[model samples]
Target: AGDIKAGRAKATQCAACHGIDGMSKLPEAPNLAGQTEEYLVKALNDFRTGERKNEMMTMMAKTLTDADVANLAAYYHSLGKQ
Candidate 1:
Protein backbone atom coordinates (compact mmCIF):
# COMPACT_ATOMS: atom_id res chain seq x y z
CA ALA A 1 0.00 0.00 0.00
CA GLY A 2 1.07 3.60 -0.62
CA ASP A 3 0.43 6.90 1.06
CA ILE A 4 -1.98 8.99 -0.97
CA LYS A 5 -0.91 12.23 0.65
CA ALA A 6 2.73 11.55 -0.04
CA GLY A 7 1.90 10.63 -3.60
CA ARG A 8 -0.04 13.82 -4.08
CA ALA A 9 2.86 15.88 -2.86
CA LYS A 10 5.27 14.10 -5.14
CA ALA A 11 2.95 14.41 -8.10
CA THR A 12 3.65 18.10 -8.54
CA GLN A 13 6.45 17.23 -10.88
CA CYS A 14 4.08 15.20 -13.01
CA ALA A 15 1.48 17.93 -13.29
CA ALA A 16 3.11 19.65 -16.22
CA CYS A 17 2.00 16.89 -18.57
CA HIS A 18 -0.25 14.67 -16.50
CA GLY A 19 -2.68 16.90 -14.70
CA ILE A 20 -2.87 17.38 -10.94
CA ASP A 21 -5.74 14.88 -10.90
CA GLY A 22 -4.11 12.37 -13.27
CA MET A 23 -5.71 13.74 -16.38
CA SER A 24 -3.35 14.74 -19.16
CA LYS A 25 -2.68 18.36 -19.92
CA LEU A 26 -1.23 17.63 -23.34
CA PRO A 27 -2.25 15.36 -26.18
CA GLU A 28 1.07 13.53 -26.07
CA ALA A 29 0.57 12.53 -22.47
CA PRO A 30 -2.01 9.88 -21.77
CA ASN A 31 -4.56 10.44 -19.04
CA LEU A 32 -3.54 8.42 -16.03
CA ALA A 33 -6.75 8.59 -14.09
CA GLY A 34 -8.40 5.24 -13.45
CA GLN A 35 -5.39 3.27 -14.60
CA THR A 36 -4.54 0.10 -12.71
CA GLU A 37 -1.88 0.38 -10.05
CA GLU A 38 -0.08 -2.64 -11.41
CA TYR A 39 0.00 -1.15 -14.88
CA LEU A 40 1.26 2.21 -13.68
CA VAL A 41 3.95 0.58 -11.58
CA LYS A 42 5.05 -1.60 -14.48
CA ALA A 43 5.19 1.29 -16.91
CA LEU A 44 7.14 3.50 -14.52
CA ASN A 45 9.53 0.71 -13.65
CA ASP A 46 10.04 -0.03 -17.31
CA PHE A 47 10.88 3.60 -17.94
CA ARG A 48 13.26 3.68 -15.01
CA THR A 49 14.95 0.47 -16.09
CA GLY A 50 15.20 1.42 -19.78
CA GLU A 51 12.76 -1.30 -20.82
CA ARG A 52 10.45 1.46 -22.05
CA LYS A 53 11.85 4.05 -24.42
CA ASN A 54 10.22 7.40 -23.96
CA GLU A 55 12.90 10.02 -23.49
CA MET A 56 10.91 12.16 -21.14
CA MET A 57 9.57 9.29 -19.08
CA THR A 58 12.97 7.62 -18.86
CA MET A 59 14.52 10.78 -17.53
CA MET A 60 11.71 11.46 -15.15
CA ALA A 61 11.37 7.92 -13.85
CA LYS A 62 15.04 7.41 -13.18
CA THR A 63 14.95 9.41 -9.99
CA LEU A 64 11.93 7.64 -8.54
CA THR A 65 12.43 5.38 -5.56
CA ASP A 66 10.44 2.16 -5.29
CA ALA A 67 8.15 3.79 -2.75
CA ASP A 68 7.70 6.77 -5.05
CA VAL A 69 6.65 4.46 -7.83
CA ALA A 70 4.15 2.65 -5.64
CA ASN A 71 2.76 5.85 -4.22
CA LEU A 72 2.37 7.51 -7.60
CA ALA A 73 0.68 4.44 -9.01
CA ALA A 74 -1.68 4.29 -6.08
CA TYR A 75 -2.51 7.97 -6.33
CA TYR A 76 -3.26 7.86 -10.03
CA HIS A 77 -5.22 4.65 -9.79
CA SER A 78 -7.35 6.12 -7.05
CA LEU A 79 -8.50 9.03 -9.22
CA GLY A 80 -11.55 7.26 -10.77
CA LYS A 81 -13.17 3.90 -11.31
CA GLN A 82 -12.29 2.26 -14.59
Candidate 2:
Protein backbone atom coordinates (compact mmCIF):
# COMPACT_ATOMS: atom_id res chain seq x y z
CA ALA A 1 0.00 0.00 0.00
CA GLY A 2 2.79 2.36 0.89
CA ASP A 3 4.48 1.45 -2.36
CA ILE A 4 1.27 2.25 -4.18
CA LYS A 5 1.27 5.68 -2.54
CA ALA A 6 4.84 6.12 -3.60
CA GLY A 7 3.82 5.12 -7.08
CA ARG A 8 1.17 7.81 -7.03
CA ALA A 9 3.88 10.32 -6.31
CA LYS A 10 5.87 8.96 -9.22
CA ALA A 11 2.80 8.90 -11.42
CA THR A 12 2.77 12.64 -11.92
CA GLN A 13 5.13 12.06 -14.78
CA CYS A 14 2.69 9.59 -16.27
CA ALA A 15 -0.18 12.05 -15.97
CA ALA A 16 1.01 13.87 -19.05
CA CYS A 17 -0.30 11.00 -21.14
CA HIS A 18 -2.14 8.74 -18.76
CA GLY A 19 -4.44 10.74 -16.53
CA ILE A 20 -4.12 10.92 -12.74
CA ASP A 21 -6.45 7.93 -12.52
CA GLY A 22 -4.66 6.22 -15.44
CA MET A 23 -7.04 7.22 -18.16
CA SER A 24 -5.20 8.29 -21.29
CA LYS A 25 -5.15 11.81 -22.68
CA LEU A 26 -3.58 10.83 -25.96
CA PRO A 27 -5.32 8.52 -28.41
CA GLU A 28 -2.18 6.47 -28.75
CA ALA A 29 -1.72 6.08 -25.02
CA PRO A 30 -3.73 3.28 -23.51
CA ASN A 31 -5.70 3.53 -20.28
CA LEU A 32 -3.72 2.06 -17.42
CA ALA A 33 -5.81 2.36 -14.28
CA GLY A 34 -7.99 -0.65 -13.50
CA GLN A 35 -5.59 -2.88 -15.45
CA THR A 36 -4.31 -6.07 -13.86
CA GLU A 37 -1.00 -5.85 -12.04
CA GLU A 38 0.38 -8.81 -13.88
CA TYR A 39 -0.44 -7.21 -17.20
CA LEU A 40 0.88 -3.84 -16.18
CA VAL A 41 4.11 -5.32 -14.89
CA LYS A 42 4.53 -7.36 -18.01
CA ALA A 43 3.92 -4.37 -20.19
CA LEU A 44 6.38 -2.21 -18.30
CA ASN A 45 8.94 -4.96 -18.25
CA ASP A 46 8.49 -5.49 -21.93
CA PHE A 47 8.98 -1.82 -22.50
CA ARG A 48 12.08 -1.87 -20.35
CA THR A 49 13.45 -4.99 -21.98
CA GLY A 50 12.52 -3.94 -25.50
CA GLU A 51 10.32 -6.91 -26.23
CA ARG A 52 7.29 -4.71 -26.76
CA LYS A 53 8.59 -1.75 -28.62
CA ASN A 54 7.35 1.79 -28.42
CA GLU A 55 9.86 4.60 -28.61
CA MET A 56 8.40 6.65 -25.79
CA MET A 57 7.56 3.71 -23.52
CA THR A 58 10.88 2.06 -24.15
CA MET A 59 12.62 5.26 -23.22
CA MET A 60 10.52 5.73 -20.12
CA ALA A 61 10.69 2.15 -18.88
CA LYS A 62 14.39 1.88 -19.43
CA THR A 63 15.08 4.41 -16.71
CA LEU A 64 12.69 2.87 -14.20
CA THR A 65 14.00 0.42 -11.64
CA ASP A 66 12.26 -2.90 -11.10
CA ALA A 67 10.87 -1.54 -7.85
CA ASP A 68 9.49 1.42 -9.75
CA VAL A 69 7.81 -0.96 -12.19
CA ALA A 70 6.28 -2.97 -9.37
CA ASN A 71 5.14 0.10 -7.51
CA LEU A 72 3.46 1.42 -10.65
CA ALA A 73 1.84 -1.95 -11.30
CA ALA A 74 0.57 -2.10 -7.72
CA TYR A 75 -0.77 1.42 -7.89
CA TYR A 76 -2.57 0.95 -11.17
CA HIS A 77 -3.86 -2.44 -10.06
CA SER A 78 -5.28 -0.74 -6.98
CA LEU A 79 -7.34 1.39 -9.31
CA GLY A 80 -9.19 -1.69 -10.52
CA LYS A 81 -13.00 -1.39 -10.29
CA GLN A 82 -12.74 2.36 -10.77
Candidate 3:
Protein backbone atom coordinates (compact mmCIF):
# COMPACT_ATOMS: atom_id res chain seq x y z
CA ALA A 1 0.00 0.00 0.00
CA GLY A 2 2.95 2.30 0.55
CA ASP A 3 3.72 2.05 -3.15
CA ILE A 4 0.11 2.81 -3.97
CA LYS A 5 0.19 5.91 -1.79
CA ALA A 6 3.42 7.03 -3.36
CA GLY A 7 1.94 6.39 -6.77
CA ARG A 8 -1.08 8.48 -5.95
CA ALA A 9 1.17 11.37 -5.07
CA LYS A 10 3.23 10.99 -8.23
CA ALA A 11 0.01 10.64 -10.16
CA THR A 12 -0.99 14.22 -9.49
CA GLN A 13 0.96 15.01 -12.62
CA CYS A 14 -1.09 12.41 -14.41
CA ALA A 15 -4.34 13.92 -13.16
CA ALA A 16 -4.21 16.49 -15.93
CA CYS A 17 -5.14 13.76 -18.36
CA HIS A 18 -5.75 10.64 -16.33
CA GLY A 19 -7.61 11.52 -13.18
CA ILE A 20 -5.95 11.43 -9.77
CA ASP A 21 -7.75 8.09 -9.37
CA GLY A 22 -6.83 7.01 -12.93
CA MET A 23 -9.88 7.99 -14.88
CA SER A 24 -9.07 10.14 -17.92
CA LYS A 25 -10.47 13.58 -18.56
CA LEU A 26 -9.16 13.74 -22.10
CA PRO A 27 -10.79 11.75 -24.85
CA GLU A 28 -7.40 10.97 -26.31
CA ALA A 29 -6.12 9.63 -23.02
CA PRO A 30 -7.18 6.20 -21.90
CA ASN A 31 -8.46 5.72 -18.39
CA LEU A 32 -5.72 4.42 -16.18
CA ALA A 33 -8.09 3.50 -13.40
CA GLY A 34 -8.78 -0.15 -12.76
CA GLN A 35 -6.39 -1.31 -15.47
CA THR A 36 -4.45 -4.50 -14.80
CA GLU A 37 -1.01 -3.99 -13.29
CA GLU A 38 0.64 -6.04 -16.01
CA TYR A 39 -0.94 -3.95 -18.75
CA LEU A 40 -0.05 -0.69 -17.09
CA VAL A 41 3.52 -1.77 -16.50
CA LYS A 42 3.95 -3.01 -20.03
CA ALA A 43 2.46 0.11 -21.52
CA LEU A 44 4.67 2.35 -19.47
CA ASN A 45 7.72 0.31 -20.34
CA ASP A 46 6.85 0.30 -23.98
CA PHE A 47 6.40 4.01 -24.02
CA ARG A 48 9.66 4.52 -22.22
CA THR A 49 11.49 2.16 -24.53
CA GLY A 50 9.78 3.43 -27.68
CA GLU A 51 8.02 0.23 -28.54
CA ARG A 52 4.78 2.19 -28.29
CA LYS A 53 4.60 5.53 -30.02
CA ASN A 54 2.50 8.28 -28.57
CA GLU A 55 4.33 11.62 -28.51
CA MET A 56 3.08 12.59 -25.09
CA MET A 57 3.43 9.12 -23.65
CA THR A 58 6.94 8.77 -24.93
CA MET A 59 7.98 11.89 -23.14
CA MET A 60 6.13 11.04 -19.97
CA ALA A 61 7.25 7.43 -19.81
CA LYS A 62 10.87 8.44 -20.14
CA THR A 63 10.48 10.45 -16.96
CA LEU A 64 9.39 7.40 -14.98
CA THR A 65 11.72 5.09 -13.19
CA ASP A 66 10.88 1.40 -12.97
CA ALA A 67 9.61 2.08 -9.49
CA ASP A 68 7.30 4.77 -10.78
CA VAL A 69 5.80 2.40 -13.29
CA ALA A 70 5.27 -0.26 -10.64
CA ASN A 71 3.78 2.12 -8.13
CA LEU A 72 1.51 3.74 -10.65
CA ALA A 73 0.34 0.38 -11.86
CA ALA A 74 -0.38 -0.70 -8.32
CA TYR A 75 -2.28 2.46 -7.56
CA TYR A 76 -4.32 2.38 -10.75
CA HIS A 77 -5.05 -1.31 -10.48
CA SER A 78 -6.35 -0.82 -6.97
CA LEU A 79 -8.85 1.69 -8.31
CA GLY A 80 -10.59 -1.19 -10.17
CA LYS A 81 -11.87 -1.04 -13.76
CA GLN A 82 -15.56 -0.56 -13.10
Candidate 4:
Protein backbone atom coordinates (compact mmCIF):
# COMPACT_ATOMS: atom_id res chain seq x y z
CA ALA A 1 0.00 0.00 0.00
CA GLY A 2 1.11 3.53 -0.75
CA ASP A 3 0.72 6.71 1.22
CA ILE A 4 -2.14 8.73 -0.23
CA LYS A 5 -0.89 12.01 1.14
CA ALA A 6 2.53 11.52 -0.41
CA GLY A 7 0.91 10.42 -3.64
CA ARG A 8 -1.13 13.61 -3.78
CA ALA A 9 2.01 15.67 -3.36
CA LYS A 10 3.74 13.78 -6.13
CA ALA A 11 0.87 14.12 -8.58
CA THR A 12 1.35 17.77 -9.48
CA GLN A 13 3.26 17.00 -12.66
CA CYS A 14 0.53 14.63 -13.78
CA ALA A 15 -2.10 17.35 -13.45
CA ALA A 16 -1.31 18.77 -16.89
CA CYS A 17 -3.04 15.87 -18.67
CA HIS A 18 -4.56 13.87 -15.90
CA GLY A 19 -6.35 16.43 -13.79
CA ILE A 20 -5.61 17.06 -10.14
CA ASP A 21 -8.76 15.12 -9.46
CA GLY A 22 -7.60 12.26 -11.67
CA MET A 23 -9.86 13.11 -14.58
CA SER A 24 -8.03 13.70 -17.83
CA LYS A 25 -8.51 17.05 -19.49
CA LEU A 26 -7.04 15.89 -22.77
CA PRO A 27 -8.84 13.50 -25.07
CA GLU A 28 -5.70 11.47 -25.58
CA ALA A 29 -5.21 10.88 -21.88
CA PRO A 30 -7.40 8.36 -20.19
CA ASN A 31 -9.42 9.23 -17.12
CA LEU A 32 -7.50 7.81 -14.18
CA ALA A 33 -10.03 8.33 -11.45
CA GLY A 34 -11.60 5.20 -10.07
CA GLN A 35 -9.26 2.96 -12.02
CA THR A 36 -7.92 -0.13 -10.31
CA GLU A 37 -4.53 0.44 -8.67
CA GLU A 38 -3.20 -2.67 -10.35
CA TYR A 39 -4.23 -1.36 -13.75
CA LEU A 40 -2.68 2.02 -13.22
CA VAL A 41 0.55 0.47 -11.95
CA LYS A 42 0.74 -1.92 -14.89
CA ALA A 43 -0.01 0.79 -17.42
CA LEU A 44 2.69 3.02 -16.01
CA ASN A 45 5.14 0.16 -15.82
CA ASP A 46 4.41 -0.76 -19.42
CA PHE A 47 5.02 2.79 -20.46
CA ARG A 48 8.25 2.78 -18.49
CA THR A 49 9.43 -0.52 -19.93
CA GLY A 50 8.45 0.06 -23.57
CA GLU A 51 5.91 -2.74 -23.47
CA ARG A 52 3.31 -0.08 -24.22
CA LYS A 53 4.40 2.89 -26.21
CA ASN A 54 2.90 6.32 -26.34
CA GLU A 55 5.48 8.91 -27.16
CA MET A 56 4.60 11.32 -24.42
CA MET A 57 3.75 8.70 -21.89
CA THR A 58 6.91 6.78 -22.56
CA MET A 59 8.99 9.86 -21.94
CA MET A 60 7.10 10.77 -18.82
CA ALA A 61 7.00 7.29 -17.41
CA LYS A 62 10.69 6.78 -17.86
CA THR A 63 11.51 9.42 -15.30
CA LEU A 64 9.39 7.89 -12.59
CA THR A 65 10.94 5.82 -9.84
CA ASP A 66 9.27 2.64 -8.63
CA ALA A 67 7.90 4.53 -5.64
CA ASP A 68 6.60 7.25 -7.93
CA VAL A 69 4.65 4.73 -9.94
CA ALA A 70 3.17 3.23 -6.81
CA ASN A 71 2.30 6.61 -5.39
CA LEU A 72 0.75 7.78 -8.61
CA ALA A 73 -1.38 4.69 -8.86
CA ALA A 74 -2.47 5.18 -5.28
CA TYR A 75 -3.38 8.81 -5.80
CA TYR A 76 -5.36 8.18 -8.93
CA HIS A 77 -7.19 5.25 -7.45
CA SER A 78 -8.10 7.28 -4.40
CA LEU A 79 -9.95 9.86 -6.44
CA GLY A 80 -13.14 7.81 -6.74
CA LYS A 81 -14.73 4.41 -6.41
CA GLN A 82 -13.28 1.53 -8.41
**TM-score for each prediction?**
0.95, 0.92, 0.92, 0.93
Global Cα lDDT for candidate 4: 0.90
Flag regions of model 2 displaced more than 4 Å. none
Q: What is the C-alpha lDDT of each candidate?
A: 0.91, 0.86, 0.87, 0.90
Q: Which prediction has more favorable lDDT, 1 or 4?
A: 1
- Tens digits of per-residue lDDT for model 4, 1-82: 7777788888898899999899889999999997999999999999999999998999999889999999889989989964
lDDT per residue as tens, model 1, 1-82: 7777788888999999999889999999999997898999999999998999897999999889999999999889888863
What order do candidates take by lDDT, descending?
1, 4, 3, 2
lDDT of 2 by residue, 18-72 (tens): 9889999999999998898889989999998888999889888888888888888
**The 10-residue segment with the lowest total lDDT in model 2:** 1-10
Deviation from native of the Cα of residue 15 in model 2, angstroms: 0.8
**Could you tell me how far off, in angstroms, the CA of residue 33 lies in candidate 1 after the best superposition?**
0.8
Models ranked on TM-score: 1, 4, 3, 2
Q: List the lowest-lDDT window of 10 residues for candidate 3.
A: 1-10
Whichever of 1 and 2 has more TM-score, that candidate is 1
